[model samples]
Target: MNKQKIAVLGPGSWGTALSQVLNDNGHEVRIWGNVPEQIDEINQFHTNKRYFKDIVLDPAIKAYKELSEALDGVDAVLLVVPTKVMRLVAKQVAETLDHKVVVMHASKGLEPESHKRLSTVLEEEIPAALRSEVVVVSGPSHAEETIIRDLTLISAASKDMETAQYVQTLFSNHYFRLYTNNDVIGVETAGALKNIIAVGAGALHGLGYGDNAKAAIIARGLTEITRLGVEMGANPLTYSGLSGVGDLIVTGTSVHSRNWRAGDQLGRGEKLEDIERNMGMVIEGISTTKVAYELAQELGVYMPITQAIYSVIYQGASIEEAIKHIMSSEFRQENEWS
Candidate 1:
């Protein structure tokens, strides 16, 4: 593979982890962040102490405070920012972009109010003239393990096969692997919706529920996710892939997941505002829950798991009450694909 200069926007854990991967692949990585202290730390100490305390980053992974300077002469742009700021950052990238580049986003969430996927948001902000197909790189990978060079595999999904294959080649290494898929809609939907189930799983754990409850959440949550995904014209088989069931299992079961952590706090009777304040990172699942709830209602899709989590998060309903409601509801045959 030819060495390329790539710009990575957002210096958060995921962004920093991916930058390390690109650097490992012998590519010139320019990481852009808004925080001056983070930029200085990456430059001076070769570490992002805020996110990864002990791991040292490569010296070749240069950090930049200026957006334009980072985007300068880059071959591809990997967006790892929060879903809330995706539009703003993509717009800024569009305005600063002087040439076309392969644009990919690792964000997982639907746009609030618009109810559009992150790729749709990216497409709206970044013009077709300024970029290639909007690729969504998502799956069960977590940044904490990824930074330590643990084995991780994820999907590189796009409508364009060449672009997806290019991204797969760009990020693949001994420790990290990428599988290319053409189901952009399924990948994005599964990636985003799984977070909500993860929140529910974490909440169940916090409530002292055992493995049985959590397992039920995972299985039923996938059903709800696939239901909505299919309603939105996604391939049903995609739900069984890395970005769907794989992501659901990892995020819902692991303590490393931000959405799960937030849900755990919620289960312990903590306020959403307090949890957000303490986490100091964007919990994409919180907003994703709202969007999924609204979208399910709009589409007339039956999403009991999403609805239960939504009630707890939005309606201020008690977690126990929500679970009770779910358990006591009318019995139905399993494996109903509707």
Candidate 2:
């Protein structure tokens, strides 16, 4: 394997775990955090206090407070910050680095108001030269389990097969595997849309729905995503890949998924405001619900599940009302669109 200096930026759990993976791969790893205290903690105790607590980070990974110091000798960058913080983080990195980097993002979201995917935002904010190097890596992996070296699967999506291949090698380890895909748009859209649907699934599950009901909701949710993605010219096969159903399955069921947890609270009669105050971290689905709802409307696609999620999260609509709306309005045949 070609050894390249890797810099994992972001002080979050996912970023720290990925950096630890690179450190284990025998590559030079430099981690950069926007916070000074996080930098001090990582360098001193080799653990992230706020994020991945108790998990000892790799000794090979060095921490840097300054963004420039992290990017200085790095060959590639793994951008794992949350969706909302992505642009600011990219802008900071762009100031110090000019070369084409193998930029990979683990964030699965679109800017809520702008309705732009993370890759699109990165392409616009980061230089065009770096745009060609930009790649989206997403899949079923959750940071909590990955920290313990659990088996996980992810896809490297980029226009350039060689770039995807390089990223595949860049992240692959014994307990983690990477796959490559050229359907960058589809992979990215699936990654984002699944989070939106996972919230709906969690809400349904928390509402005392049976396995059959949950399965039906998930199937229909996927159909909604496929409709929107297909309208945007994304290959249907891409939506069926790891970045799609694989991610959806994990996010919908895993207790560690912030989106799922938030949805559960909503279903159990907790208000969105209270959930947000408690989470402290970003529950991306709450933000993504708005985008998916608006995009489906703008694209003239039928996304009832996304609409329900949006109404409950943003429109001040009641959870019971959202359920009533979905159950009463639809009596269509299965696979009717096909």
Candidate 3:
């Protein structure tokens, strides 16, 4: 692959890890973040101590405080910002961009107000002439593991196969492998909705539920996620693929998952505000629960797990009571397609 210059917006853990991947692939990577101190740390000591504690970044990976400087002469931009701020950042990138570039986002979550996917938000914020077909890169990989050069498999999805294949080639290597998929709707929906289940998994673990309960939550969680995804026009089969069950398994079970960790804290009787402040990272599930719950109601989809989580998080229902509510709901066949 020919060497290319790429701008990675959002210098959070995932963005920084992806920058390392691009650097490892022999590409010139410039990372942009809002925090000046973090950018300074990346440029001076070649480390982002807050996110990747002792992991020294490649010296070749440049950090920029200015958005325009980061976009300068870059062939593509990898956006990894929080979903809440995605639109604002995309607008900034649109203003700074002078030419058309491939814009891909690795962030997962729905827009709270519009209930749109991140790609749709980008397409709305960015001018059509200055951006290529927006691609979504998502799967089971975690930033903490991926930064250590661990073998990670993820999917690069787009409605346009050419754009998806381009991203696949750009990011693929020995440690980081990419699969191209055309099911952007399923990929993005699965990626966003799984976090809601992960929060429930963490809550169950905190409530002293064992592996059996966790397994039940994961299975039933996938059902609700698939139900909602299909209602939103996603292929039902995509729910079984990497971005679906693959992401759900990892995010719901791993210690590195912010959503799961937050849920655990909630289950342990911590306030939502306190958990958010302590985690110092965006717990996508918290906000996603709100969106998913509202979306399910609007679409007339029954997502009992999502509804239970939404009550616990948003309505201040006790975790124990929420679990009871889920258990006491009307029983249905395990594989009921209706």
Candidate 4:
């Protein structure tokens, strides 16, 4: 594989982890973040203590406080920032970009205001002259595990197959494997919507529900995700792939998931503000639940699980009541469309 110079924005857990992956692949990785102290630590000590407490990053991985310095002459750019700041960061990158680069995002979210996918957000913010077709890199992999060089499989998806394969080559390595897919919509939809189910699953565990309930949440939550994804023009089969069910399994079950952790805190009677404040990171599902709830309503899709989570986060509904609301809803055929 040819060594490429890559710019990674965010410098958070996911961004730091991916930069390490690129460094491992013998690529020149330049990381950009807003925090001066974090950038200093990474550049001076080769560690981002705020995210990885024990791990020391490769000395070759450089961190820059200035966005332009990071983007200077990079072949590709990876965006791993929070969805909330995706547009702002993309716009900044657009302004700094001098040549065409393949843009990829690892964030899993919909814009709450526009209810649009992050890829769409990038497409709108970055001019076509500055970037190729946007690619979505998503799946079951978490930054904590991935940073440790754990065996992980993820999708590199885009409407353009060549571009997807191009990204597939850019990041794939021995431990970090990338599979190419042409279903951009399905891949992105699954990546973002799974966080909602993860929150609900975490809430189920916090509520003292047993495996049966969590299993039900995973299974039924997938149905809700698939239903909404389909309504949003995603292929049904794509939901069964890594970006869909695979992502849902990891996020909904793992303690490493911020969305799940947030839901768990809520189930334990913690306030949303307190949970957000304590995590010190973005729990995307909280906002995603609201966006999914609104999208389901607008698309006339039935998503009780999303509504339950939304009720808990936005409407101040009790966990027990939310679960009760879901359980008490009228039953439908196992395969209604069939």
Question: How many angstroms is residue 109 displaced in model 4 relative to the true structure, after the best TM-score fit?
Answer: 0.3
- Give me the displacement of residue 231 in model 4, in angstroms: 0.8
Mark the regions of model 4 whose C-alpha exceeds 4 Å error after superposition. none
Tens-digit per-residue lDDT, 1-338, candidate 1:
99999999999999999999999999999999999999999999999988999999999999999999999999999999988889999989999999999999998898888999899998998999999998999999899999999999999999999999999999999999999999999999999999999999999988888999999999999998999999998999999999999999999999999999998888888998999999988999989999999999999999998999999888988999999999999998888766
Q: Give stretches of model 1 more than 4 Å off.
A: none
For candidate 2, the per-residue lDDT at 31 reads 84
Please, what is the whole-model Cα lDDT of each candidate in the order they appear?
0.94, 0.83, 0.93, 0.91
Cα lDDT of model 1 overall? 0.94
Report the Cα lDDT for residue 239, model 3. 90
TM-score for each model: 0.99, 0.96, 0.99, 0.98
Q: Could you arrange the candidates by lDDT from highest to lowest?
A: 1, 3, 4, 2
What is the per-residue lDDT of model 2 for residues 85-150, given as tens digits with 9 covering 90 to 100?
Answer: 888888887777967777888888887678888887888788977545578889888989988999
Candidate 2 structure lDDT: 0.83
lDDT of 2 at 124: 76
Provide backbone clash counts, one per model.
0, 0, 0, 0
Error of 2 at 82 (Å): 1.9
Error of 1 at 66 (Å): 1.2
Cα RMSDs of all predictions? 0.8, 1.5, 0.8, 1.0
